[model samples]
Target: MSGLGDRILGLGLLVLAVAYGWTAQQWPEPFGGAEGVGPETFPTILSVVLVAGSLYLMVKPDPDAQWPLGKTALELLISLVVLVIYAMLLEPLGFVIATTLAVGTLSWRMGARPVRAFLTGLVSAVVVFVLFNYGLDLSLPAGLLEVS
Candidate 1:
């Protein structure tokens, strides 16, 4: 896809960014607030950056860009599917499990050996989970790993 297609994709992303930012703003205000930030801060910033990027892409689309074909196209499709599934399963499977599955599969696809790929995924997932949950005070779902 080139030029017009790029603009179209940009417009779509712009719309999504607007919607996401609006939704982020609609999150209920924290009660008994002592904290300096809320859950929506990161998403709001992300949406704003996406909006800027989308607008830039829309205005300056590459005219000579070529769309991916064959194996490249298949890989892109597979990556998209993995991300969508990761989003869907995040709550039920928990952040660590879902992230491991998604990252491991992607890493494996990129030529990492299966064992090493999954081990990387597992380590990364755990580290990020701990950082976000403890350091940042962001609560990721524990899912099946929840302690009773």
Candidate 2:
């Protein structure tokens, strides 16, 4: 039972990685000759990385790994909830707003001042939004900010 938790976590992540990769593959292929990255490319890459990491964990789990407790555990839970909420709200609130709220809350929980945390969130969100929407030529959902 020394590394039981790590083993179980590895198994869970392995399953998730397989499912995620499968789902990514289900996305329609880009409407052209397969000459560049498509919708599934990034996800597939992540899934591959996750799979490898999960396999390594299964093969050689950290015997010293211990679950966080008390405040640290609560913080992890809060971060998870924020991320889940961010995903749920992304399409409706837009990437920028949802990312700002998620990042700000997580930052505040990590001991940052409220105003500074939110300002950081706002700046990071705007930068990422611009990077994905403009630099990468990929369109994120504009949601509330959508122009007519």
Candidate 3:
């Protein structure tokens, strides 16, 4: 009973990992045929890792696991809401804007000053955007920033 919640969470994550991997497999092949790594590679790798972690959690539930309450619970709720909103707004607002807002809000909740948190978010988002769009050649939504 000590880690009942952890066990349940692990089980849930295991199911999610399976579904995620399955969904990744469903993506259509690239037009010219998948060369090196396709779009599904990263998600498939993540799902595999998640499955391993979930299995470990199920096998070794933390003996001292404690559920959050009061302020801590509220923070968790806020973070979840932010992530849900981030996903919803990603396409419309573009990766950079959506990510900046999500990261900034989460950083602020973690006690960073508002200005500094948002600046950090902006920098990180831009860095990631460049890395993915330029370095890796993976395109992320440009959202409102689209040139036309």
Candidate 4:
């Protein structure tokens, strides 16, 4: 991409980061404060980091870096399709199945080997499921499998 394009993308991302931070700040404190941090603290920190990174990119962009716009658009389209399919099939296919399929498809589209991608996807899905459902005590849809 051109320098101007990089600057534009960076500025856009920075704006989004600021907006996310502002929204997080406006969110009601549903979860009680813990010691010094609240539930919104992590998201706020992430937004700040995003803004800082975008600013850095805008200021000192690498000249040699080539932006593969076409490839990126294809990848984005594939990702969106995977996400939509995952959502639509989540109830019937179950979380594990749907998530595994989505992740595998995305990984393959990104140039991973089929077998390796499948295993990686399965592991990622299971780990995420366990982390959110058990570790964080978040209620996620169990789907048909009822793994939860």
Cα RMSD of all models vs. native, in order, equals 1.7, 1.3, 1.0, 4.1
- Model 2 Cα lDDT, one tens digit per residue, 12-113: 999999999999999877677554667788889999999999999999998899999998898899899999999999999998888899999999999999
Name the top lDDT candidate. Answer: 3
How many pairs of residues collide in each model? 0, 0, 0, 0
Error of 3 at 11 (Å): 0.2
Q: Distance (Å) between predicted and true CA of 129, model 3?
A: 0.7
- Lowest summed lDDT over 10 consecutive residues: which window, candidate 3? 33-42
Question: Candidate 1: minimum summed lDDT over ten consecutive residues — where?
Answer: 28-37
Which portions of model 4 show Cα errors greater than 4 Å?
31-39, 69-73, 80-99, 113-115, 136-148
Cα error, residue 122 of model 1, in Å, equals 1.2
lDDT computed for candidate 2:
0.90
Error of 4 at 26 (Å): 3.3
lDDT for each candidate structure: 0.91, 0.90, 0.95, 0.81
Task: Write model 1 residue lDDT over 56-77, tens digit each, in one string.
Answer: 9899999987789999999999
Which regions of candidate 1 deviate over 4 angstroms?
A: none
Model 2 RMSD in angstroms: 1.3
Compared with the true structure, the alpha-carbon lDDT of candidate 4 equals 0.81
> Candidate 4 lDDT, tens digit per residue, 1-148?
5477678778998999999999888866656543355556767999999999899889987767666689797788778888988989987877777888988888898899999898988999899889877877654567777844
lDDT-sorted candidate list, best first: 3, 1, 2, 4
